[model samples]
Target: MPAAVVDAALIVAAVLDAMLMAEADRPYAVVSTTVAALALAVRRRLPYLVFALTLPATAVSSAVVAGAVALYTVAANTRNRRTLAVCAVIYSVSCAATVGNHDLPAPTRVDLLVSVGYNIATAAAAMFLGQLVQARRDLQQRLAEIHQVREHEQQLVAQTVLAQERAQLAREMHDVVSHQVSLITIQAGALQVNTNDPDARTTAQTIRDLSVRTLDELRHMVTVLRASGTAPTELTPQPTLAGLSQMIANSGIETRLDGDLPTDVSAAAQRAIYRTVQEALTNIRKHAPGATATIRVRHDGDTIEVVITNTPATRPTVPLPGAQHGLIGLRERAELLGGTLTAGPTSGDGYRVQLRFPATTQ
Candidate 1:
């Protein structure tokens, strides 16, 4: 049930019970009783205060339910046992004092004993019910924590397996792939020297150059994969504003860099800008092929913003495999740097990604 519904029900029931028990003579009793009963609306937030308001009503016949419910709420929410005991005792005394408000003569010994015993028992019952509710709430919180811990453990296990596999793959690439690529480079260099034909010599030289670049890229990957033992590690020498021009040229899409942004921003801010552009360009390639992209980096006051917008794809998009967490990681990183990232489809049937962050940080 919704909490609002439960609260409404409690207030209604308490008011109706108060009306039934109220004497017809005292209009003030009716008003006071109703006010105390209505106070139940905020019992969850101010349990002790609400109970105190209900205490005066407890010594009259009109507000029986209000006092009991208020006492119960205090017991359910309060963690201090001594405080709860004190509240319970006060409630019992007020309830027993209700007899003094009755029309009958001063009560005999047996009646007084019964009144005290019965009121004490009622307060005890409310305490027990409240304690039961408190225990259930604590149990539910513990169960939620257990579920979260279980999920974290599973992620750790999956990461360990992935790290082991990458380590093994790195070894193979270093020993087998690197060795073959080196041999190809050597053979291409030899052919370039020994060939007499101009075309063959030129082709060998091209092959040698490509092989050497491949070896360098391969070594970079191997080093990264081998070092990633416990977490998903990004490649070293991460891209920044200094490489923005070169990256745009190499992205394979028709693109324009539209701003001359500052280069003195902290390295973290630069990487955020670089990654935002890189990811935007990558998505354009995958999901919006043949699209034209415009990257605009702006510095206004102490804030830097990068806006990458792409026109609609000129060709049909081919489905590609991706982890799909690039934007999530970027969003998380931006928040860590006191920044924000937003991406969505444009009004012109295009896509746009915007990244904003503070320009300077210690």
Candidate 2:
């Protein structure tokens, strides 16, 4: 109901309680009864305040009901131990005042005790029921909060698992397919130079042969990575740092490499570095075709750095389409080895990628 309507209803109830108190032979009935009735207006919001206001006026029978309502309100809305203790004291006082006011004979005193006991018991039951309801509400709210937190944690876990799986797949593709395709490209180039028939002579023949071999190796890698239908070791050879130079050469891009690389680098780090170099070259082939590229690897005191750069092409560069997680995966791998990777367009408009990996001292 609207505020005006609720206030009008409260005014009517207070007038009725005042009139009822006037019929009794109580002293200061109107003033005391009006105050107790007015307290009911804010009983639920301020339960203990209502109990304090109504307890003094509870000498009158009409005000006794108001005190009981206030006690019920406190039990329903609050779980404070002090509030409960105060209500218990008020209830005992009200019960004593009610029994003392009644002028009964000795035999009826037993009846009065039974009636007062039942009334106190009934009031206690209401307070207990309200407290039970409040406890249930609090438990439900906590459960909802816990469930929401669990769902948020589950979403984070799922995203992390998906990211790790993508990185692992990228690593496998670079390891198995890149090296095999590079070998096929080199063998095809040698054949092109030795073959003499114009009909049989095709520059595209080298790319086609390499792509076929790459597909076969990719299928085998997929089977191994699945692990459910096949053993991981049954797949083809796992490449090491030795295959990186050939990978850079196979994409029909001119390249230069310098410095002796550590062959003993961990297999995981080696695969990550090879993939980084291959991705850089593939980006060059797609974005800066016909541009000469250089990949330089250097071993510092406790770090290994790989830098790949290419000259700007005559045409504008277009980004390649894929998962777009290649560079992100490379960065993650570098970070796992306590290193870093950077990729961006150079000042001369060519693309450049640089990566650093920390070496294990042992």
Candidate 3:
């Protein structure tokens, strides 16, 4: 219906009810009806408070029409189930009491019966309407909660994807750079002792040639990673137990390899050991570039252990941002493999990193 039509209908109802029913002529009845109508204006804003304020006046005046409307408003608008239920019971009881108290003659019987029927119909209809309102509100709330949970799950998936991408990039860089740097380290050590011989010039040229090739490979790898639809290269082969001795020798660190290595250690356990060695060497290069270092790998039956210790360099090393992140990452990896990693300054005036892993195939 149009707004004008609705307003006109309501005005007509109020006027006709006031005029036709002599009971509305009473001051209490007129006042109660006006108050109830005004109370309904705020039903959506303060439903329970409005109902409480209007109900007693309605009951005292026996304004069944106004009281029933207020009860319906309370039932439909408030989320408080207990309050609505209590209002419903009160309205029902007051209606029954008001009807019983009326002493009517034969002429009034029809009016009384009509009033009772209207009350019963309005009560039933209002309760059903209130239930519909409550159901709609509950459904909206549930949908909002579900949407939030799905959004949170999506954010978590995005973060995981980003982290995996970073790790893959790091692996690619390591493969290319480690090989070239290894050549530099080998040639530099060779030059420290070999002062004579024309063959030294040939060896230096060989190192430079290998480094150029490695740089070309690195450029190709980076280009492949950036271009759309290019399939990523196979993951870099993770270092294993066999690479430990080579790593120590290449690092120019004095390392003692003793005791038997568990041949049946889990892949996770082996990876942890490799990462521990890699991080220790990187830290040494950055902090104690020319310091003497020692690394030990041993298996004591049920456990595999690796320990790396380096002497302090003569000059103080500047700390770098996220230097601790390496140790933290190494520790987390160790714990995941049912092992432990500890890295910090040692009492012997240098840094030390230790990793211990369970030597079990499972």
Q: Who wins the TM-score comparison?
A: 1
Q: Point out the worst 10-residue segment of candidate 1 by lDDT.
A: 229-238
**Regions of candidate 2 where Cα sits further than 4 Å from its true position:** 1-27, 102-108, 188-362
Ranking by TM-score: 1, 3, 2
TM-score of 1: 0.57
lDDT of 1 by residue, 172-215 (tens): 45434554565566557667877999999999989888887887
Model 3 regions lying over 4 Å from their true place: 1-73, 80-118, 160-237, 245-256, 280-295, 308-328, 342-353
What's the lDDT for residue 283 in model 2?
61
Local distance difference test, each candidate:
0.79, 0.66, 0.61
Q: Report the lDDT of model 3 for residue 7.
A: 38
The lDDT of model 1 is: 0.79
Could you tell me the lDDT of residue 158 within candidate 1? Answer: 88
What's the distance in Å from true for residue 164, model 2?
A: 4.4
Select the stronger candidate by lDDT from 1 and 3.
1
Would you estimate the TM-scores of all the predictions? 0.57, 0.48, 0.53
